[model samples]
Target: MEKFPGAEEWVPARGGLPKVAERLKDCRGCDLWEDAEQVVPGDGPAKARMMLVGEQPGDVEDKEGQVFVGPAGRLLDKALEAAGITRDSVYITNAVKHFRFERRGKRRIHKTPAVGHIVACGPWLAREREIVKPELVVVLGAVAARALLGTGFKVTEHRGEPVELPDGTAAVATVHPSSVVRSEEYRRDFGLFVDDLRAAGALLA
Candidate 1:
């Protein structure tokens, strides 16, 4: 099998999550390390059956070193509550561990991660999937769909649909929570986003 770009060096050849964390702390596999505050590794149970992956860390996540803790996260929390999924019940992470941004005066505007950035970060995400072995992967955007599914992934066509991988793990794609925040029809779009999350959670029932 072909190995992902930085997997062997970054993820443990032997250890578990802690080891992954250690390598991630000093990862220089990509230039994203030069600008971001730190690696925002996935957070939740060690063996969660459901994994929720997003695009990348936002400004808040970069500063705090936590996944989904900003405006987007707050919205996700609300939707998850409505969906009957507890925050602690699943793992949450980003497609890219580091924040890629363009600095404006006082703020760092989020820049969509280039393909190379995602390719470089693939190993860490693969390791996360390997370790967690989730029964369900909820990809929360086109970026995440591409990272977890493939380059050809289209959220518009496949969102909320359960796709079975060759390995037999199940994944569903959806709009990132941030999209709802950016949408002009926040209320309507937010409802649809919650519906998608509810469907993903339904598989567990």
Candidate 2:
């Protein structure tokens, strides 16, 4: 395991997300960073009212050093626009900063980050929430939900409902855009995901 920087001692002195991102460049708090090209920080308006958190980076994201630029991201952009939510109006990020993957021939297949890894990277998420202070937090899948709430979070049962956080922020759970894209039943589920995005948008409005 890679030795990460001490999370307790590495508080950011500068304000805003960019400065926080600068701090993350040297993050050795978890082993994921060692293999990851670099930490992918959340992007968008620092003063956005809504923040959307997904699971983690994908192959394209890891290569491009930007969040949500792949097929899933394109879908997310379309859904957000359809729901009357501008992409620039919300902050977007992943629960885990690094892209965890397994090599399969020439392809790098995505691997879910373990709970321990999530916990190890929790401090960065916390820092993001603090800086954004968004009115509504949209968690796009169970993994993101679990990282924000707890392990037992059930996305199927809880999706579209707003849950209040201890920090006075409201959170909404929904299917990840990538899941919607991968489903053979995308026609049926895509509408539902769009509805969920609309609901999240309403909360922000």
Candidate 3:
């Protein structure tokens, strides 16, 4: 495990999303950038009411240079629609901007990012939160939960329950969309995921 100084220095003290996105490309805050194709920053309106945060970019997202455009993303879109939450109304990003993976033959299998990676990427997520100031943050898995809420936050225990942060921002945790995509009981799991989203949506309402 390597230690990084974190991304605070790379983040501009005064700028909006565009400036953050542009400067993110040049961040050497962690070694994850060494293998990643590019940094995939958060995407959505500057002042969305909600924000969705995941663990990190997948192979497709790393290649495409976009967030929430993979199979999991497609499922997320469907789930959001089912929850009566418009996709365009929320901002989406990952806790870590780079794609972490293990090469297996011709395939790049997704690897969960270590805590250091999340810590290294903290500044970027903080910047996005500051700029968006979303009414509620939807954390899509344990990694995301840890990034925003802190370590020891468990999605299984608190899924669909809105928790107030130290800053008074609300957040809800749920399994990653990929988990539902990979579930044996796909329909059931997806339905539950939508239910969680709907609960979060209700908080917004």
Top-down lDDT ranking:
3, 1, 2
State the displacement of the C-alpha of residue 116, model 1, in Å, after optimal TM-score superposition. 0.6
In terms of TM-score, which candidate is stronger, 1 or 3? 3
Whichever of 1 and 3 has more lDDT, that candidate is: 3
Instruction: Give the range where candidate 3 is weakest over 10 consecutive residues by summed lDDT.
Output: 162-171
lDDT of 3 by residue, 1-205 (tens): 5689899889988889999999999999989999999999989999999999999999899999999899999999999999999999999999999999999998999999998999999999999999999999999999998888888777899999989766789988999999999999999999999999999999989
Worst 10 residues of 1 by lDDT: 1-10
lDDT of each: 0.86, 0.84, 0.93
RMSD of each: 2.6, 2.0, 0.9
| lDDT digits (tens) for residues 16-91 of candidate 2 | 8988778877777767777777778889998889999999988888888899998999999988988888999899
Error of 1 at 108 (Å): 0.3
Q: Could you give candidate 1's per-residue lDDT for residues 1-205 as a string of tens digits?
A: 2233554466676677777777899787778888898888889987998999999999999999999999999999999999999999898888899999999998899999887788888888888888888899898998887777787878989888888755678888899999998999999999999989999998877
Candidate 1: segments with Cα more than 4 A from true spot: 1-7
Model 1, residue 32: distance off in Å is 0.3
